[model samples]
Target: GADVVHAHGLHAAARTALALSGRSVPLVMTWHTRRYAEGARRQILHLLERRAVRAAAVVLAPSSDLVDRARLRGARDARLAPAAAPSPRSSQAPHEGKVRAELGAVERPLLVAVGSLVPHHGFGTLLDAARVWRALDPVPLVVVAGEGRDRSALQQRIRDEELPVRLVGSRDDAGELIAAADLAVLPSRWEGRSLLAQEALRLGVPLVATEVGGVPELVGEAAELVPFGNGEALARAVVRLLGDPERCAWLAEAGREQAAGWPTEDDTIAHVLSVYDELAQPSPHPR
Candidate 1:
């Protein structure tokens, strides 16, 4: 009775219905991420992934890397359909004043990072960079705007090391915080085309982020890149950007231009609909 089955990942919940529903339906799977595993568990997952790829009518990946991986896993039709960020027009609200005031209205350089307090987010590296940033004559404020289980641990490190960093916990107005900053940073150890990076670029905020996952592809020449987990590199990138206002301005302008060319949510939906129209056609042979 179903026209098609749309799945979002290689996980059980995403693929189970397509694999076991015992019905003939066009299946579309969107590959968002892949997890690390080992031993028999890894083999099991690999096998399941192969089966899922074989069963899917089409696989949509957010980046070329994911599309390549899907094809390697035996997906019949894998295509690139990069994820879209919120339109810049909608995010133009000016809450920057309120956001800066909440952070003691700091007059010095302000760096913003927006992600949960997770280890893989590489926030510990940011803390180390903050220490380096603080040794300067006018210390900068590093504001992280997200919450997670590692909150206590990060807070403890800040207190013990006397680092110039503050965790603002979860924030609904994260775009405002990014807008209030002199720069944005994403020290992720791994990522799948970070939404934060997209948002930062779209908002015309210069960024210093780790060169991991699809970040290089996402930012193009619009931002500075640093190696993952290298606090020294992260700090140096920040210093370079902060010292050069002209370069920062160029990056901000370039980021906005690049982000403008990126596909929007409506584009993604239209692409999906196009695929559906193709797959929904009746075959020459009747079932």
Candidate 2:
């Protein structure tokens, strides 16, 4: 155990570090996710994170965006680490028809976009694109989970657009829904790297998402990228996935392969411990 300790995110890894630090153990700090692009409120948050960041033995970042933000907030030396991706806790095999049935989606083709209803998550863009898809062939069902202050407005947008969508806000069973989906998407304007996308890829759902932040870093060949806020392009990709069953199946399988090879929950624990180890290690050149 390190003389000082720190951790990031809400997972057990962060909690463990906090618990150890409570015994007067020195724990460093890490910030894995932040609100969004900088503005007045963001600057205020940056100020707060900056204050917290300076006390850490070493700051850790799970995505380049977060790394950059931490650096911007004065965490210049925060170590960079890929976000630890945990596989589905139980059986989550995706059957063609059965999985769709569970989600109340018909057996045509399903394109799921998972994220908060917030502006940063791009749920509104997703709904707008889905409206375009309504006129396209083999229309998809967009199943979104997560809740925020924008939930009501997003709901109104859904009603206004008349999109084929299901808004399952703030759920624990989101993984099962991801498994049931044909594709998983994140339409966020900015992101630190979406945990939702990681989980979806782990379940091997085909990914149609935007190119931003660490998303491109993790999704690699598994996703079709579009510019952020280009509803037309995003809509086209969804339609493409929906129209082609063979391709959808292939993408789904490919996504699973990529996500399965990613770090496990235990791996997250190991990485976090390694950070603590570095903080505890003897410095070659010390004051």
Candidate 3:
């Protein structure tokens, strides 16, 4: 007999399992994020979310905000266990000079962002901030590396505005680029413990990210947090960090320290096992 069912998201497969089994076994559902494109699809997912939350034996959330959302949906047991990261490849520091050279021949302050070129990822806001930053004495080069359906539209905007932003399509060495950046910016509208945030902090890259979803939880004062969707705020934060070298160094050092304390893959596995153990215990009988 199966001991438990673990559902990652409110996808069709998870919905099917919930429908077919009706909570026959202990069910653990991890709510990464509730973000979805608005429409009939979003409505359907919200309904599924309610059903899944009610049926789950325990809901694991990466941040407390999501735990609250789960409880609102009628989840009886919701726990916070921030996502784990793979072990670092080596303790050696990243070579900033080499990585910077790889970015481009242009010698300008490099700001790197990596994510799908989608509306929710909020590349539009970043582009606007780039436009605003162009007046700086030494203009920065905003390099974005990713691919999505919004590629064509974003490209057109870049051309129309004549912004100092480059959409370099997709990149494999995104981590290297991030390590080389004068600043790592994530102006996402919504997020749930992003891997990019983790990578930036781990590499000791000074970060300026939007305060949305679990981003604050990940950065935890180690990086500058800006309000989401405000291009002016994003631009100001980036400009301030670039001008203050000492502040940037402090943020980078603090980021590395924060990243050091993150849970490892083994720790995540152990937490999952403990949850299973709790579920497997037999209940006491009443007389």
Candidate 4:
């Protein structure tokens, strides 16, 4: 009954007690993007974004680059309010052997990714990577999780590529695969936050992600970052990591270290409380 709103993400909106209509109140908006265009309009969207932030009580962004971008857009006072990273301990990472058996992965090196099967996620690029991996003596099996409107198109692509990929469909057990897989990949066009990538890192798993959005800010050295939408680069990273267990182990440990900073539910709650407190503080009369 007594609280102020703290908004997060592109669709979030916060309503605070501060008023301009002294009745309309001020908003605290959290911008979660850095290097992506906003609308279909071929115009000054970035500048428009700053004007929107200027109307807010406080401008909070998940990454420093986002803050800088917001400033560049012309927000006089934008700050970083990073998202809470989830802890690996609470993650339901399943036993690799059990999951492998369940998924019939004993015969192949499983290269898997779990996310919305859309153009932005680069399902096509993943297919290309699989093609490269298959050129080797023993090919890797690609299993994809997630369901989207583009399923039919992607299936056609698989047929065209003649790749050994099985669409596992929307899954509730991605944690099992994340633990079982020989490789975890996130080939995306954009990501203000990659919770999928975070899950892999939490399980002390290695990742092959493209350099995009706020992912680099989150993963640090935990992942092998390649250029966006580059099939060759994606395949190279996947093959290199899959071929070398010693390097994979190093990457796994590095992921664990980076994942150590992941914020849990507790952190989210505390941050909300802090924002409410900040909003509730009475404003001093201007001289």
Candidate 5:
């Protein structure tokens, strides 16, 4: 029999709770991200999320924002447990010239945004900002990495509006692409210690991100932040950063310093194992 059951995400927690009904095993749940749905579907998920959090002996979340969310959802014991970024695949240098040439951004300010092309990821907002970037001295090239259901709609809009943006679908070398760009943009509506942000910072690339969820806490003063869904603000921030070489250099150094403070994979494992050990201890008062 299992001593403790650990579940990740809302659906997994719900399923685990149902399976462990009337059992004595303690449930530990890790809340990752909020499910973005609308109307009845959103309501159903809210109820399920509440039930799952309430059932868990302890809930773990990657950021303080998520920990607060879990507590508000009825989790009795919620704690911050940030997930570590995966180590780089190889030490090989990023092909900056090759990536710039392929994207047709050889003489332009190359901007990169990487994530699933979904509504909540805010690709639409980035496209709107791209429209603003069009009036710059040398039009910037915006390339997005990743594919999703919104690809068709986004592509259609890009073609019709003639926005200087390209949806590059999915790429295995997203990190390399990020490193090659002049600026990395994260226009997410919400995020929890974003992996793209981590990777960008770790690579010493300057970043412009939406100030939502755990982003402010994660990047601190290292990256420029704009309000979520504000295309104009995002565009302005990007323009300001690009025009100031000194500021950009400072931000690059700051980004590297910030990333160095994040928890390592081994640290994450040790923290998780400690939680398990604490919960697995025998009861002091036997009934």
Candidate 6:
């Protein structure tokens, strides 16, 4: 008999609660992100989310926004447990030049955006912004590294508009790609402690991200933040940061400083283990 069951994501927690129907085992849920479903699917998810939050003995969230969300969904106890991004692989540093040349960003500025090619990820907004960069000398090359159902449509727009953007599909060397760029863009409509943001800052690469969800809390003043879904603001921020070499340098250093304040992998493990220990204890008055 398990003493505790830990489930991650809304769906997993809901299903786990259903599976544990008549059991006494305590359940711990971790809310990662909200499902971007719509209409009937959205309503169904809302019901499931409520059930999951209410059923969990404790809900762990990676960001403050998510903690609030869980509480709103009826979680009795929710705690902030920031997820740590894995440190960049040291070997990737040596191949930076090679990556830039391969991506055809050797002479021009390289902007890297890593996320699924989906609507909520806001890659479309990024492409719209890239259109503005066409007039610049040595136009920046925007390379998105991920794959999803929205790939075909995004690719079509890139070609139709003659945008300097390329869908590189999914790559295992995302860290390498990010490290090799002049700037890293995170145009997502929402995020909870974005791994790309963490990696970019850690590598001393300047970043421009949307001010949504936990991003502001995560990056603070370390990176340039613009309103979500605003292509002009996004483009302006990127251009301004690129032109101001001094600020970009300052931001790079500030990014590392900010990243230093985030929870480390060991810290995350210790915190989670403590939660497990607390939950495993027998109640003073057994039910």
Q: Which of candidates 2 and 3 is the stronger one according to lDDT?
A: 3
lDDT of 3 by residue, 166-192 (tens): 888788678777878888999998878
Worst 10-residue lDDT window, candidate 4: 12-21
Record all residue pairs in model 5 with backbone atoms less than 3 Å apart, i.e. clashing.
none
lDDT of 2 by residue, 1-287 (tens): 44754555524334554456446455566666665546787667555676666545567777777777667766637777756665447665556566678767775566666666778888878877888878855666778888888888988878887878778778776777776776788899876657777877766677888898788878778877888998999988877776787887777777778876776668778888777676677789866
Q: Give the TM-score of each candidate.
A: 0.89, 0.82, 0.92, 0.85, 0.98, 0.97
Candidate 3, run of 10 with poorest lDDT: 85-94
How far off is residue 242 in model 3, in Å?
0.9
Per-residue accuracy of model 5 over 202-228 as CA lDDT, tens digit each: 888999999999899999999999999
Model 1 C-alpha lDDT per residue in residues 146-219, reported as the tens digit of each score: 99989999999999999989899998878788888989999998777787898888878999999887788889
**Cα lDDT listed for each candidate:** 0.85, 0.72, 0.84, 0.75, 0.92, 0.91
lDDT-wise, the better of 1 and 4 is 1
Q: Compute the lDDT for candidate 4.
A: 0.75
- The numbered model that scores best in TM-score is 5
Clashes of each: 0, 9, 0, 3, 0, 0
Instruction: Report lDDT (Cα) of residue 206, candidate 3.
Output: 93
- What's the distance in Å from true for residue 276, model 1? 0.9
* lDDT, residue 71, candidate 4: 75
What is residue 105's positional error in candidate 6, in angstroms? 1.2
Residue 6 in candidate 5, Cα distance off native in Å: 0.7
lDDT of 3: 0.84
RMSD of 6: 1.2
lDDT of 4 by residue, 1-287 (tens): 33344555433432232233244344667786543454664256554464566666677877677787767766666776657765445665567878877777787788779888777888888888788877875778888989998789889988887888888899878777887888788998877668778878877778989898788988997899999889999999988887899989998998888888866678766775687677877678633
Q: Using lDDT as the measure, what is the rank order of every candidate, best first? A: 5, 6, 1, 3, 4, 2
